[model samples]
Target: MQSFEIDKSDLLRIKNALEDNDAELQRVLLQYHTSEIAILFEKLQPDERERIINVLPTGEASEVIAEMDEEHHPAELLVNLTPEKRSEIVEELDYDDATDLLSQLDESDQQQILRDIDQEDASNIRALLNYDEDTAGGLMNTDLIKVNGKLNKNEALEEIIRQSEEMEEFYTLYAVNDDDILLGILSIKDIIKAKKEVTVLELVNKEFVYVKVDLDQEEVAKLISQYNLTSIPVVNDDMKLLGRITVDDIIDVMEEENTEDILKISGVSEDEELSGGWRNAVKSRLPWLVINLGTAFLAASVIRSYEDTAAKLPIISAYMIIIAGMGGNAATQALAVTVRRISLSDLTDRQAYITVVKEFLVGMTNGATNGVIVAAVANWYDSNPMLGLVMFLAMTGNLIIAGLTGATIPLILKRVGIDPAVASSIIITTFTDCIGFLLPLWLATKLLL
Candidate 1:
């Protein structure tokens, strides 16, 4: 086969055929230029889109539909088809993509489509759907190419030929026993290189890794990343072969994991899909804002507790905020770094202790530098040497404590079996503000007031 040479003329011709409802031209484009045919399908009016979809072979349509924007994908194509047509379309889609498309629709519609699909395919899709969409099983395809352990290379090649005739996406062939217990895996490259007389069991690599169906998708991605596997087999805890998770699914899983962590650290729920509607966006953000409001008052209440001390020395209010802000930034930087380390498993043995000590040292240096600057500026602005000196002393102490608190809070949270990442921001912020407020007010009352 030669590489496709698509040009503007090709696109236009396909568009013209779609518009004119010329079945012959549509057939030609569908046969030779799937990409061009897809573009034409996308350009058609709703009814025209339905006509094109109805006419195209499901496999070609599925491959073309998979190329669409996630938010505007096969769901868009499905809405125009009958339930039976939708099932046929889904049955031809790669497993992960099929699950994703059905998941986008209303619950009732999704169920209807699934109920009408082939029983085996529907079962696989349902199983994938049952797993959290962010896990290994959820991201795996059901199109595994498996063979009995007894097959010789010749027999295995024959099996693969017949299987590949119907299934084209497989990478590795899982060699399993009669009971479906996994024995090993053999890559297609190995199959091609081997003597045809050899048994698949002899060709299979028993040392190959597999993921359990229930494993977290992030862990699956980490394994794939660490080993650079193109596809990996997934199994039940009992070692029964399930299916293979592809590189493409791992990429999506990695993206979803990254998105989930980013959102969680921002105090948003993991399920708040960023592509959702306005109601969803607002709903996801408001709870965090409200919790922050209450937490803000906790920081504020620290100041209220010291109001008497502050009133006697108004200069403290002006400089205290700056001191507090400086401490907040240092703590936040430390917290973010530590949280990422824990998330990525970059913090190794006793490294958390090293991190704590380094951050405290950093805090001490940071606090002293900022305190001197704040004190000097305050002294010049207020002409009160005592107020300036108090600001200097308080900020330095607050910043050091901020560093100690920042590093330890997450470690402590992890020790207590909490999600250190999710709770880190609130803990770091509240600590810095409260401690910054109190330390400064204490220094002010003792020295300036």
Candidate 2:
């Protein structure tokens, strides 16, 4: 297969073909993969994208739709196609993909799309649609290869071939009992290596990892990663296997979750949907800015209380900003690590305490090192050792405050049923800033005034 890169030149050729209704349009498009075509869709008008989907083979069109960034509203693009084309493309989609696409559409459109597909597909899509998009049920695909544990190796091999014919790929072969309860997972290698007389029950890995349908998708991803699994089975409360979540879907989930966490850490609302228009962008950000502004005043008030000292020692103004700024930066570093750790696993009370202590130690060592350096600079500049001493004490104190609050606030928020990633930054900043200012000024007042 030839490699291709979509660039300005490719975009220009595609656009000219689109504009002129050129005969070579389909031929030109066929050379690129659906994923590449989806990237092109981001630059084209919606009508042009709809036309491309209409012209492409149903299977390819479905992949294009699936591959389109969620920001482009692939659901809306499908709805724009003629009803027949829409139904055909949707029918070509897998149950999980179809469910995700339909869930993005309005209720009436979703129902219409669901109604248009085959009954079995519609039923599976509907079941998946009922799940919250953040859960295992929402992320799982009904398409999986399975065999009864009682089946002999030959029988299981036959069943696998029959079941896998339509699937693009499969990882593990799930073994189930007569009740459809997931007994365990079996490797395809184990099945192929087994003697013809051996039952699947004998080959099943009964200790395999699986998740309940209602489990959080992030937790599901962690399980797959920790166990080094390519796919994982999703079961109901009774342990009946409903579906499997593939590694591909987990990759998408991880990207989305990481993006959300990054935004939240920067004090943006997760609901902002970064894909939307200016109105949404402003609406998402304004409230947070206002809250940040409020915190700014609190920090300013600390400085106001020290106006007399600052006015007498004008040099202090320049260094005050550095002290507070360093404290905020240190707190942010701690916040990022703690938030990442929290996201990866549920920390035990002991682990949480250890994390706090570790951050405190880190803050102390870093603060002392940086503080001494700044102190040396201060002493050299003014030929006054007292100024240097005040700076060293203040930096060390503020950093300790930064480290403690950075570690503890997130854990406290998690215990209170709040998202640690969202609120921790703001709280940590307030603590660091107030102390960062207060500590240096108090030291100056007591030691130098």
Query: Largest TM-score belongs to which candidate?
Result: 2
Query: What is the C-alpha lDDT profile of model 1 across 158-260, one tens digit per residue?
Result: 8888878767667788999999999998887887898877888888899998999988877888899989999999899899988788888777767766777
lDDT of 2 at 100: 91
Residue range with the least summed lDDT across 10 consecutive positions in model 1:
35-44
Error of 2 at 199 (Å): 2.4
Candidate 1 stretches greater than 4 Å from native: 1-80, 103-108, 275-277, 346-349, 383-386
What is the C-alpha lDDT profile of model 2 across 403-444, one tens digit per residue? 888899999999999999999999999999899889888889
lDDT of each: 0.79, 0.90
The TM-scores, one per candidate, come to: 0.82, 0.96
Q: What TM-score should be assigned to candidate 1?
A: 0.82
Candidate 2: the clashing residue pairs are none
Q: How well does candidate 1 score on lDDT at residue 129?
A: 83
